[model samples]
Target: MSWTKKVLRINLTAGTCSPEPLNMEWVEQFLGQRGLATKYLTEEVPPTTDALSPENTMYMITGPLTGTMASTAGRYSVVTKSPLTGAVACSNSGGFFGNEMKCAGWDMVILEGKSPSPVYISINDDKAEILPADEIWGKSVWEADEWLHTKHQDPQLRVAAIGVSGEKGVLYSAIMNDLHRAAGRSGVGTVMGSKNVKAVVIRGSKGVDVQDPKAFFDATNAGKKILAENPVTGEGLPALGTQVLMNVINEMGAMPTNNWKDSVFEGASKISGEAMLEPRDSDGKANLTRNGACFACTIACQRVSTIDPEHFSVQNRDDLHPSYHANSGGLEYEAAWALGSDTGVDDIDALTYAQFVCNEQGLDPISLGSTIAAAMEMYEEGFITKEDTDGIELNFGNAEAMIKCTELVALGEGFGAELGQGSSRFCAKHGHPELSMTVRGQEFPAYDPRGIQGMGLGFATSNRGACHLRGYTVASEVLGIPIKTDPLETEGKAGLQIAFQNATAAFDSAGICIFTSFAWSLEDVAPQLNAACEGEWTPERLGEIGERIWNLERLYNDAAGQGASADKLPPRLTEEAVKTGPAAGKVNGLATMLPEYYAERGWSPEGDVTADTKARLGL
Candidate 1:
């Protein structure tokens, strides 16, 4: 069967691990991964419950296709209430871990209640245990991972672990797996830390089987062929990875620079994908070692890169980890924009070092770097002094200052403790809330909404704060994946955003990479699922499931006080205009779009799901 048909429930308070039957009914409705996990969360955890309390429940779930022969089927999601945003948090990650979980005969691992002391979960097929983590309790993710492998004497053990920043309660801490891949948003790791979970180590030998082996083989082969022929998936992504977006986004005037004070960065080309390929002066080698891939991923878009040894950031730093000396997960577009352009730093090596620190210490670089940008703005505006930043001059373009901030925040020490609260709270505390550049207390991503209008609407209503991954209208507006649309126009974008959002939800639920959508639509995805699982999965059915999942998450956030009133952007985006580039003299017209979006979603004017709509979805 495609379904493992088993759920592992780990109660830390009782120090017990029990197997529960998979709810087939919920699986049919929600599909898997994000949707199914959220359903379990809604049933077990209350939205009003304190996110850091023992009451909160965390679910690590995989999709039906995970660990199978399907391409890019290695995705997993961590679902829980976010301590950072006070809303639903579902951070997706890709690595060997999801495949391991599925192979270990589990579809989901649900953690309930808090442990009295630091502990790690060790899973070996059907056997599971919670063991003391006193030795690795205060270690970084990399350090803990090393310790686990050494102690277990199993180099293949897949580990998802938090770092010292997480243990210290950094609001944007992430869970790093396979050394570099991360569930890197909405403070999922902070919640893990609060529950005293230091790490999850798993190894599996039982392989996944689909409903029909011959049909599954045909379906997967066809899917992989589509990826191979598509330019975005086959050539562009594999050649330069997500770093390809740095220059393209900057050229489009959608790159948010200096905390959204401007929409263009002069250093865009200097820190772009092309730059990563240029030979370094010291060793005559490029930063990128090669392209890598997740389990069964044919695209091979994951970047493996290293910092230049002679670069100022790491040249004399004995504090740097040995892995930094070698190759690791490199700067993607989001990390580059946040740490490089948004903060006014052009040094690629410095950005690389900062990204390494993020993976090493389990911090969300997007939130961390964006928070630093806000601090830089506040420092320049005389809102904060050097004394406030522990005597570090935090002016924009100060690479040393940015690196210092990264190191401090990695440990959650000194002034880093304040920065760990995230940009929205940090800016508000410094008497400059308007400069935060956020929606729902989460920092905005690479694309500036002023240039790409639909993103503003997507960011405003995202269930998990100001995240771009939730809807990603950029495919249509900027890349024109399926069809070309005017980036500046507000007309018809309401329907466009809804289409992308619902479709994305389906892709995320199906245990696949959303990047596949660059070429494949739901029409392409339906056949794969239908062949693998025992179901009649059509594009229309998947679309309905996606809509239902969106409404369900919306209801949860509504009850958590992040209701329709919270669906909005910072005044800077709505009130101030873009100062330069193609979108100069323009501000985001979110007000003109939200009403239309609500109507398209069959929701009330206030953005609440109507009773009739709920009944239609059978919610």
Candidate 2:
């Protein structure tokens, strides 16, 4: 079977490491990864428990397909209640960490109770221990990672560590693994920091054994063939590395610019994927050095990039890490948009520098940039001033200012301390709650939902707040991945959003990249899962599991006091229309779509999962 069928329970309060059998019944009901971990969260931690307190448990878990030959099987999730949203937080990351965890003879690592002092977890094979992290606690992710590798004397050790931002309790901080891959969003790292954890370093030599290796190989190989043949997964993503969408979304008039006051960005082309390939450095190298991939990924959409040393963000900045000058992970499309067009800054080098800081410091670039953008809008409106920003020019398109804010947030110092609270709290504290472009206290990503109608519903109703990954309707509404749908029309969007959300939940639970959905569906995913695990998997069954997962998370939110009422867009999105391009004069019709969405989901008119629906899904 794909599952290791064992879990490592670490009670930091007791400094004890124990192993327990996994709940096979729950695994069958929830599948794995996001779904399974969420099951643990809902059962162990109270919905109203303070997200940063010892009562809130953390699940660093892997799915069934993890550590196997399945495409994108390296996926892992950090599941806990979010300090940012006071709701469920499940942030996924792609790296070698998930595989290592599974190979270490554990399907999940349950971290509960707060440690008395700063510490880190080190696991090798079946042995695990908690050790003092005094030397690495306050360091950046890169510094801590280097120290861990050197001390352990294992260059191949997979380390997931939070940077200074996380250690100091930046609300939107992330856990960075394999240097740049992050379990990003919804303040999971803040939870880890609150628990007094600094890092998790693992080295595993055991291997996974599938139920039917031949069947698994065939199914996985066929899946990889689909990815390699698809245009979005094979050609566009590999060539442009998700930064492909900067120009495409901008051209479609869906790119959020200037904190989403504008749907079109004039500087979009200047900082696009094509521009990333253009040589602008004194060394005559493009900002993008090459494409990289997560463990077992065939598409290889990750960007390995370098910043120009002459750029003002890095020039004479000895305080900056050396990673700023060399090749490292670069900005993807979302980071580019949030740090670039959303803030009105088109300087690629500046964006690259800020992106490096985000990776090095383990910050969620989406919330970090969106927070600064909100602050910029407030400053320009005279709602806030130089006094609020500590005399810094919080203006749109000010690359230096943007970089400064990013660095501050990374280190949790100066004005950065205020910005690190995330856009929702930052704006509300400044007395302009309407300026925050967030839902459920989490910032929206690059898309301007005003242009894409389905995404509005998706964002408003997202279980983990305003995240595109919860239901990336952009794939269907804009790219026509499965079928073409009108991006402007609200009609039929409800069912579409439901379908995508259900399918996405399944993908997340299956231990594969959601990017695989650009080419694969539950129909394609079922075979691989069936071949790997001891189950008779089918698309319809997987879909039911997905729906169960979604409704379960919804039920958790309802108890957490963030359900239904939190499913709303900002005044700017529902009231203000786009100002230019094809979406000019258009606003999101969330009101029209939300009710239909609820009805399709078999929820009440108020958006509560009905008794019949819960019974049908066995929730």
Candidate 3:
């Protein structure tokens, strides 16, 4: 009853929009959102299809729980082949835009083929149209966002668009929505831009309905109560956001500093969550203004922030958007660590400004910062010169240089154009692929694998390239969620990584924020799905569904030429030992854990899913 049971298929090649019945069979097998979309993609698009070519397809979809009373139900995913990783890409985001699509009578929107001209798709309830985007074609997302709002005169419309980075094929470009929230990873936006489509705007009045409303309300309320009672969800997140991990990770010696040259950063505390609250000497204003939340999210981990107007980054710049003078919910732990510690820049305001530019221009800050750090190493080694960087001095601890590089990449010009190729391509082009701290051509996130042993395995085997979210062992290895594990030990970590990966896939498919997993498990989620969706869903079944989704993505990637052989950490993480902190003189034990991980997944010793696995999952 919660499902709209409808899909809107927009064929850009034909310039037509048509409605189709949702495939209930696939939904029954894969659930919804990320899982269901991946099922559709594998069935329709070939694994070897060029990611940015017209043969590829993109799906913007929501789950059955979306637009309902379920907390954090306003979630969606963009699923496609990634130009960055050349693997399966499913980037999830939180915002009202997802719920809006459900209200407009679509469970999923499939975008395929390339447009003859730049255009945008507009939807008002059931009415959908392809409209020329001539006036706003070359504009930034913010500029086009304003123009669309003015053109439609609909303040309530939800807009999801790409910036120049996406338009110009920055390899790690993102698709941003509701201004700050992003489906941010693996170049999904590059595929969107290659299709010559500018944006997707929608507005709807049809509210969602649920079967057994009383049970749905009761289950969701119980879920919310659990979140409110948990320390991580109720207190830590709402107060400091994910940035709370900055000091914690640094103290544990798990923070990647200077692009994994070390495991500890001296300036970690200066740019941490606590520091975000400290009043700056320049204007007596703190970097963080307050905390915010996505639609239906009680956790409220978003950081609404601002930069010092008098700071050199924004000083006397008139060619900037007025919004840049004030920033939005930016500078979370990943962005801060990537642009701050990894780049050796401790300037919190400068990091905030870089984060704002990332949000505005739809660039993946993790990849951007890691790439810049690699370039800094190259520069220090005399492998790169000032002439190669368009005259900007490339150095660690230089906030101005970091800010300049971020601006250039956002616009995809000059040296920024080179950096836009992502760390893998950029490093390889400079004849130093070893300098790139990446897995499967995608840059690693903030966590240093040498310090967080399970994360090393997690990063190595992630289906979407190097990412923390796919399997976050930190919850157990650090915060003691469900159970505490030793971060430095590699024993029993293969099982831990498998459990996290499978469970995370389920959460991503169920139209909920992965942060909710901090407090709730599949046992807690089963009741809500059982009540709102048409069929019964148990915790056991949900776990199996999660496994099915994982293997499904893996199978696709295998055919795409990214498989078990691709399970690897950068040499720096696997070979180089940390210099200080709890993990001093220790490197990640990836070699020991990888074989166990493969065995635990029921895959062959070579890491391929066995015939029995395919039969069990009915793939």
Candidate 4:
């Protein structure tokens, strides 16, 4: 069997750790990672339990393919009930940590109950312990990582930890790992903080094994070749990172700018992937230093970028690590758009600074910056004044304010406390919920759903609130991956969203980066899975597994009281049309597409999974 077939259960309240065999029956039904974690959470924790209470459970899980040489197999998920949306939260991450967990001879780590004091979980092969984390309790992820490495005296140990934002109960706080990668979104980190758990460190040298080694190697090699040859996966992503989409989406007029007030940013190219490669006049060095990759990844799309030494964000900050002065993970399209364009701050270095702060402090830059942008708009409209902003000019295009707000939010300071609640709550608290451009209390990402119609449905119906990676129809709509669809039309979006959503769920559960899906589909994935595991894994079965995971999450959300009714876009998305763009006259046609989406999903018009459908899926 490919499975280690073991789970590590840690009870922080009791200060005890135990090992148990995984429920193989549930594994067969739910697959792994997001799916399996949800199954565990649903069975162990009540849906009605407060998301931050001791009763809520946090599951860190890896899929069957994790730790293997298969491309992008180093993925893991943090699954729990979300304080932000009051729904099932499953945030997936990619780094060295997931593979490390698998190499530690376990499939998952289930953390339950609250610790009386802050502690960090440490695992070395089969030995596991919860250590006092007094020194690093209030530290940033970067600080905690450094401390853990120095104290453990293990340079290879992988660490995943929350920052002060998480410790302070920031609703959109993320669990950051390997420095820049994050289990980002839905307040999973907040739940970790609530448990008084500061970090998880793993050092495992034991390698993963497959059922059929020869066949597994062949299949993975073939899949990698496909990724290496495809334009989006090969040329575009590796060359430009996701920042390649900055200019493309902006040209298509789908870029959400100035708090979604416009569908275009005039300065898009200045902060684009192409621009990152251009030499700056000050030092004659490009922003992007090089592209990096995770373990066993053939497609190296990660950006390593450097800020100008004289730039305001980095100036007079010698306490900052040398890596800040050199190069680290740079801005991707989403970060650039959310932190730069959306806030009307076109300064690339400022966005990079904000992104670095997010990575260091374990905050979701998308939600944090977008919420700040909403606050800025409210400030400009006189809905909120300088008094409300603590005398800071919370205005669009204010790079200083943007940087200040980012630091404040990261550290969970004064005005940051109010901003920590996220845009929906922040806006609602200030009497203008409509100004918050979000769906289900989660902030919207870079894409304007109005321009990309399929993404509209994807965002509104996403299981973990508004998230792009959940569906990401942009591959089909914008990049023409698999098949091209007219982005401005809603005609076939329902089926398209369902197709993408299901496929994405499978990708998430399989412990591979979804970025691999840019080139490889289930057809490519089935072979690797089939060769590695015990069962006959086919494309059809993978599709069903994806659907099963989707329905499972929906079932959990329904029981949590965030039913089909909660699957909705904010009023702005439905009522406000894109005033200027290729999709000039379009507002989201969610009304027309939603029922069609339900019918296509084999669910009721109200979005409930029907009995017949449940029976069909063995749910």
RMSD of every candidate to native, in Å, equals: 0.8, 0.8, 0.9, 1.0
The 0-to-1 C-alpha lDDT of every candidate, in the order given, reads: 0.92, 0.93, 0.92, 0.90
Q: What TM value does model 3 have?
A: 0.99
Steric clashes per prediction: 0, 0, 0, 0
Over 368-421, each residue of candidate 4 has an lDDT whose tens digit, in order, gives 989999999999999998888778898899999999999889888888888999
* Model 2 stretches with alpha carbons more than 4 Å out: none
Model 4 Cα displacement at 93 (Å)?
1.1
lDDT of candidate 4 at residue 474, scale 0 to 100? 92
Q: Rank by lDDT, highest first.
A: 2, 1, 3, 4
- Using lDDT, give the best candidate's number: 2
lDDT of 2: 0.93
Clashing pairs in 4: none
lDDT digits (tens) for residues 254-308 of candidate 3:
8888878988889999999999999988889988899999989999999998888
Q: In angstroms, how far off is 49's CA in candidate 4?
A: 1.4
